[model samples]
Target: MTALTTPREASDRGGPVADIGPLPARRGRRQHRLAPLIFISAAVVLFILFFLWPGALGLLYSFTDYRGVGDLNFIGTENYRELVGDDDFYRALGRTFLYTALAVPAHYVVSLAVAVLLTSKTAKGKSIARVVFFLPWLLSPIVTGVVWRWLFGENFGFVNHVITQLGGSSVAWQTDGTLGLLVVVIAGTWASTAFNMLLFIAAIRNIPRSYLEAAEIDGASPAQRFFKIQLPLLAPTSFLVILLTTIGAMKEFAMIQALNGGGPGTENMLMVQYIYRTGFERADIGYASAVSMVLMLILVVVALIQMRFDRKSALS
Candidate 1:
């Protein structure tokens, strides 16, 4: 009896071979094509379920008079019209912008400074310093707010106690709107700095050492080297940090809420807190949804502007 050869072996030997099925390599290629889709299917599902669907519903509700319950009577753009003329809405939006303006710059400066320090060649105890610097980013926003509140509390607080001990009057941190907002800005910056610092650190470390060495050999001072080489190179990372910080500051709610409950007569109420109060506290879901849509539009516009600026900067 003749020994049977496998199809591959027969083909190799120049004999006619019967086709069995798709080869393992072809099957593997198919699996490879499918692997990414398989891995990302869960994330896509979650995005649709949690984000897209809700956003669609919110958009739909914004055109109606849905008061969290009852009949959804269609009101067209009345909610938006009302939002346009509402002084409280404008104040909240303005306050939100103010917070973003204050917080983003502070966040950028502090984070970049820390990142530069940590990434410096002559820095000491880098490992310990990195951990200490990064710890605040691990904290929940509410927790951070609560901690700051305790430190800045109006009466019987640590800060006040220290001031009084040093023969100074107790400051109205919570009651006074400006002081309250200042505390929130400080807390927000402190809470958010670590993450941005990590981004800056990565960007800085990725900068080629040869550039700095070349600059130094050309008689450039540390500040000159940084301004001419390091700072220019860090543009992309800086833009990213600014964009993210702006968005985070715009959407700030929980921290401010936990800190002063948007208190001092809604003086410190940011847009998100305003939305929450309008939707939940007052049960004006449709109008609140409209406000949220406006906020979303503002964020989209800001992101687009930043991206455009970044592209221009990159080109120039």
Candidate 2:
């Protein structure tokens, strides 16, 4: 027990002390890293199981002829090739694109313009206006769709009734191919725009009144102050909301399907509706999976582009 080793012996021996004591080597610190590691590991595992695993399997299935009946077989790009010539695919894609394009900017502009109006002046109608505006978004989409479907129906629609009351013929509000699509877009926009408007109102309210006061003191008009100051700060949120709305509009099957049943030669058929028809009605799950994968790719590209624009707008 009294034996003392020289420094040379200790160095030469390279024994347990260096690995276990004194510095306690690299391995011991690894145990200290376990808590964070455990958290990260669990997250990764859940991510793989819930989202990534399913997505990967779906992507693989996209290339095969599974048909939801038998074992999946690898066909090697045949589904994609067929998808290239698929007319319904293109038509649905076009409708979805148009819906997102027209509906998004229209809602943002109309709603923001209304919010701007409401935010100004000491008016008695403000609270009631806010509630009325927000009430549509509060209802379930199915309920909203059902009510609006009757309100836009070709035979008994309220809008056509109004036109008739004004001495006009009952218009084909949801019968003509293009007009039916427009009705869906308008109704969809009406149901959702109020939600966006409330957000703008909240954002506008949170901004300091001192800035507006300062602007007003300098003879800056309401428009000038809003454009020069408040809007710039709200740009990030607005961009994000638009992104969400655009994506939602792209996948809007329920409203379109419920309203017109993708009527008039399936002109109102959205991408999701097409996929649904292919899968269930046509009972071609393989082809449907292929179509879905294509839709996913399109959405991903669109989202990336919007994010890039938002980022650039923020930086600028």
Most lDDT-accurate candidate: 1
* Per-model TM against the reference: 0.93, 0.81
Please give the lDDT score at residue 261 for candidate 1.
88
Q: Residues 1-316, candidate 2, lDDT per residue (tens digit)?
A: 7877766677889953444345566667877898799989999999999989988877888888887788988998999999999887898899888888888887888788878878988666988888888898887777777888888876888888888899989877766887887888788888887878888888889889899899999999977998999998788769877888888888887777777778877888888999999988987877888888888888899899999998787778
Candidate 1 — which residues are off by over 4 angstroms? Answer: 1-22
| Tens-digit lDDT string for candidate 1 (1-316) | 9998998899999999997877899999999999999989999999999999999999999999999878899999999989878999999998998989999999999999999999998999999999998999999989998998899998867999999999999999988999999999999988998999999999999999999999999999999988899999999999999999999999998888888988788999999999999999999999999999999999999999999999998898
User: In model 2, which regions exceed 4 Å deviation?
Assistant: 1-50
- Worst window of 10 by summed lDDT in candidate 1: 148-157
TM match of model 1 to true structure: 0.93
**Candidate 2, pairs of clashing residues:** none
Q: For each candidate, how many residue pairs have backbone atoms clashing (under 3 Å)?
A: 0, 0
